[model samples]
Target: MLTLLAQTGSAGADSQSLAFFNFITTHWQFCLLHFLEFAIWGAWIVVLGNLLNARGFTRKEIGSIYACMPIGTMISILILGPLADKYFSTQVMIGVLHLVGAVLLILMARTDNARRFYWLTLLYALAFSPTLGLVNAIVFKHDADIFGGLANQGFPWIRVFGTIGWIAAGLSHTLILKKGQPVNANPLLLAAGLSLVLGLYAFTLPADPSKVALAAADAVAGEPAVAAVADVGILQGSIEMLSRHPIFFLVTFVGAMAMGLYFAFGALFLEKTGVPPRTVGPVMTIGQWIEIFFMLALPWFLGKDNVNMNWVLLVGICAWAVRFGVFAIGKPLPMVLFGVAIHGICFDFFFAAGMVNANLIAPESLTATAQSVYGFLVYGLGMYLGSELSGWLNQYFTKPTTAADGTPDTVTNWRAFWAIPGVCVAICAGLFFMSTLGRPPAGDGSNAPAEIPAQASEVGE
Candidate 1:
């Protein structure tokens, strides 16, 4: 009997091992999909502002450059989201758009003229923004078939590769460029190469024609705009949620606008603060590295009932003030690093937690739409407005000057520049905190809005 039992146990173990091996072999493409998707983005975005600064573009021009992606995201939400859902294969659209974007990226790298680069970047943004949603759609549509009962586990593992890919992209700049090498177009070229590879690889993935994830903004898609616009009902429901949670609405809009200040100028800020060009890419990635840890720990912070939502979100919004305040101070490199590192908290705590709260607050029928609405407000309109204001402010603070080496140059009162957003966010935080004081905690039955059914109280929990 002992011998028979031993043999049976060995057989079961062997079967399990074989299944695990098959899982890895079949799902490797999805992992690569996410890795290359983010790698291509991280390769250039972290350093683009600094490069533009070096190229003699004004801070305002750079802000406009940054705005292109947000504009593209808004268009994709309204147009590409529906197109990918109804007419085209998700994989095919991703493959084609990325392939086109790769070409545009090459053009962008070649341009020395700011005007030309602006147009090229706008075109590239349109080509690239929709792919963010399409990639998520592919995973959501196929995870069930690929991982079966383990689909939940499979998604995060595959998604984590995106974070790794972003890290790799940043580290590559550190490795390839020597210290003090001037910022150049090389990052753009590297991104183009990766996009080419990703475009080709996307073709091999399974064909999917399903709808794009309305909650695309809920994920770390890129530079803050993770949403695509959806049904009118979703937009209406999102507006209602904002109306009901007046505090949430105000904090989210203002916080995202403040986030724009960083996205538009953080790289340039690092450069001005004495960070070497080669190391800046890796340094900017500090937040993303920290984000991985915070994201994993978020469930703990959120608690089982997510009763901590208000505090979590409030802290997240508050981090923006902290980061901007640190940047405004701009001394003691460690202090600056701390500000950079907390980007994870800013994103995971505020944005990610906010998405969860949105789902909880919305009725089941409006859940997906609610996600879309929140995304549109935060990343779409809010980010765009912020970008525009940041540009105008940077331009206002800048004055033309001659470099110490007797070359023509410009200087910005960066301290003053950063302080504006810092003060604005601080005010927003104070207002948000005050608003939450008398309100019921998130997930409580009393917290549910009149439009939400009673059972939503359980859902919130």
Candidate 2:
């Protein structure tokens, strides 16, 4: 009997191991999707301004081009969010959108006409922004119930690989691709290819649309006499639940504001620093590597016993301050590179942590809407404000000098340009510190009332 029991136990362990292996194998496609999605952006986003400049576009034009992303994201939140919830499978929508983006990317590669480039890029941005949220929805739909909470945990790990893909694309542009040119088509083509691959791969993800149908069916069965009433109740309940959480709304606003400044200033700072266009890829790679390491350790650092969300956010704010401070000081390339490394803390803590906090505060019925709202704020309105402001600032602080051939050369007052972001980070830090102090919520994962009120909450709290 003892021998039989031992044999049974061994078999059970083998079954458990196989189940875990199968889980990862089945879901591996989602990781690949994320990798390629980010790889597309990584190839061009950090260096697109330089490309435009090389092609005779002005600094203001480049800022306007970059600002398209946020604008597209904002527009999609109103249109795409409801459509994804009602009509299409999230994966199908993502696949279609990315495939369209791929074609637009190819079009971008073929164009030197600035006006054509601007419109095409706007199309690409609109298609791409919705996919970020859709991909997450698809991933969460497949995660096991026992491991549902692990969605945020494991998702970041997979997403970090996307950054790795980004770094690889960046390095490739610097080394094998650009051939030392200020602007090259290779990176854009590479991004296009990866996007196509992701579009094709997205079709293979585990089915998610069925759940929406199943919920509708269940609702019909439960209230056949009043099906319309039941539908209204679900919608009303979701809105009411979201409305009750003021902190969630406030944090979303803060997230938008911080991200706006970060994205806008990040591109402008690199351009002002006189970093050669080809070299910016590797410099960005250094920052991405730091981001990867920080993300890998985040679960441990922010887990139950370690740092609370407030402390993590505070450190992130400080890191942003330090990063821009280094830039403001007019440091050498190496020091500037080191400061860029703080991207790990700045992004992972502020943005990624904000996602986690959103997850914590959102009720199950409103989960998708809540997360989508956060994206809308950060990528849409926040980015819009950041890009416009940064452009104005760049125009104000940098004087135009004439090149030897009579073309204009833009010379930035690096100290003043960099100091602006440093001050922004300082203000973010102050707001966060005060919010944390006012309402000290139980930091131990209990769903106690959040310590901070919504209107005053910092970006990720």
Candidate 3:
């Protein structure tokens, strides 16, 4: 009997291992979905400003261009988020939008005139913004297929590939392009081509069927502007989810703030530390590449079945504070790389982990909106406010200096500027732990673990 049982157990283990391999293999489309989706952003995001500078655009004009996407996101989510969740298949919308965006991006590369470029970008943003939420919704919807009852584990594993795509795009900028010249229309051309490929590729991925039960957002998809606000409350489930776990909303806001600060000033700070401009994209991407390590381990850290979401978020906040401190020190190369690398901890814990938590408790009917709410808080509002604030701070802390040709150059007070955000985030991290915040309980409800005492009363509401 013992010999027979041992044989059965060994066969079972082998069978399970084979099944896991099959799952990963079959999910290549999802991985490509994430990879190409991010590659589109990566190709142009870091290089666009540099390219515009090369084109002789003013700072204000460039700032307006930067502002367009957030504005587009805020607007696009209203229509697309609801449409995907309630009325249309998510993957189909993703494909269609990318197709539209591809044309706009190509037009952007071909046009040098400011007004035409601005409008093309704005239109592209409208087409592109919803894809961020749509992709997350699609991934979350299919997570169960990857890990059966343990869906959250699959998210980080799958998401790590998106970081890879971003890294690949950065490398293309650094290695394939000539050294020391600002990334020109070529980056957008690359993005446009990728967008077109992804547009076609999206349709080949797994389907995310629209919810049969319609929500208020769907009823008003074509309605007038004011009607949307009055009617938008129809997203009662998503709204309730936020209200129930106020802490999630708070943490999301703070996470946005921290990331906003980093986005606004991180590159400039590194340049001040003497890193060359051409290398900036690769150096910055070091964070995303390293993020894969933490992302790989996240499932283990959060436990196989049940975990506390707040703990992960809190640690991420702490990592941000520490990372900011590292940046503040204004250290040299290898050491500075350590600071950049901390992004693995910072992003995986806060943003990526937060997504897991958001999906965990959200009603099936409202998953897209839930993710949209998070995106609007972080990428939309947070980034916009951060960019504006960073502009003011940049001017405030700058000292005018003369270059070798007697022309004026702006010397930023890097140490002081970096210290301000560092101190602020450290304080925020401390305050985050001390606050009475409720996190969405981790795990699918079938095997839910208890939450921390601070949020115990509000755990399931």
Candidate 4:
């Protein structure tokens, strides 16, 4: 009888352990949500440029396809964010958007015409982008309920699965589609299928507290907002909040611009280094595989009592410069791969850290709005700018030349192209570091997030 009781106790402890590992929520729906959300994006985003290139599209034309996503993201965040924050259920919005986006993805697969492809993708992105913020809000709300701290303790671990999703997508492309060799292949269809699965799965997520309810809570006076934006309106309040905190806005711009170049031309850089068509996806996955480690490390790195998240961003952008420099050197597959692997540091530090920081600073009510405002500034407008800039850089560097076979070739001066962005980003990193040099991260605002709530909904009320 004693032994049986001990075993039962052990089983109970194991169940508790599992729940803690899952951030102690009723379920781990958000982790699955992140996985599917990113997997759909990963299915084609990493290789779509190369696919378009295979079809005889110019770099500029390929950029147009890439550019549409930011345009779509910007529109979704600006419009949908306010609507969701003010009126609708976050999970419901996510489900509906993914379903709509799935149809668009299917349509994208059926097209070979560039204009048709561009419009279809644009519509899909518009449908898909707002979910990024809504998912974050859901995760934050769950974290607040469970962990009750300024920083969401299990968020990094949860988000790391999203990276796993991207890795899985790349693995599928490499193992199944063989690095997206054909201009029209299985990528879009694969992504569409994944989107459909996630759409249906979204309805099963934890329910959200309405912004209207939260707004009412704020109006009760003395009790601060757990989920309402300030009286200035969701969009206006979010913008005002971001503007007040210059650090967030600055890093968002830098990170978004750097990402644009990576999204637009990263594969092309690998191709220049003689990576084979079949190997491209795997090679890229190496970076994300490395990122998984960094993502896991982030909680420790930035989770200290007062470790400034800005310091994390500083490391990321510096790594970005180093990566471009290494890519510029461009020889020996191992060397190129080594540099690519540093993406672990580059991406996790800036973008991932930025998301965490955004959470730290915004009130519970405005979490979605904060994420949306940041999304619009970075993913939408910032990515669009980067796409244009990178495209122009591509055009400027390509020149007519004679190859060893005396065939006319358009030569890409990869060294110069890579170095320019590297220098500029390095400077941006330095500037960011200087700005946050002595600022420690906020700590232990158990009743509220560590950020100043003067900019929040209940402040005046």
Clashes of each: 3, 1, 0, 4
Which regions of candidate 4 fall more than 4 Å away from where they truly are?
1-30, 85-87, 138-151, 154-157, 179-183, 204-248, 308-310, 355-373, 400-409, 433-461
lDDT (Cα, 0-100) at 447 in candidate 4: 40
Worst 10-residue lDDT window for candidate 1 reads 452-461
Per-residue lDDT of model 1, residues 168-194, tens digit only: 999899776667777888899899999
Candidate achieving higher lDDT, 2 or 4: 4
lDDT of 3: 0.66
RMSD in angstroms, candidate 4?
7.0
lDDT of 2 at 421: 69
Which pairs in model 4 have colliding backbones?
Answer: 226-365, 227-365, 228-365, 230-457
Task: Report how far residue 34 has shifted in candidate 4, in Å.
Answer: 2.7
Q: Which ten residues in a row have the lowest lDDT in candidate 2?
A: 452-461
Superposition-based RMSD of candidate 2 using all C-alpha atoms, in angstroms: 7.5
- Candidate achieving the largest lDDT: 1
| Model 1 alpha-carbon drift over 4 Å, by segment | 1-26, 149-153, 209-235, 444-461
lDDT of 4 by residue, 1-461 (tens): 99999999999999868866756254467668878888888788877877777666677777777888788766654566557656777788888999998899888777778888888878887888777666666665444453453333455546666777887887786565654354355777889899899989989987775665444322321111223333347657676677767765776687678778888888777866777665666678888887777766665677554255667767877888888888788867787788878877877676766666765677766665665566556667888988878877887888878889987667788889888888888788777777776666644354432222211110000
| True lDDT of residue 446, candidate 2 | 53
Q: Could you tell me every candidate's TM-score relative to the true structure? A: 0.86, 0.78, 0.76, 0.77
Per-residue accuracy of model 2 over 170-265 as CA lDDT, tens digit each? 877666445445657767788888888888888877666376553443232211112222244545644664576554455445545545555545
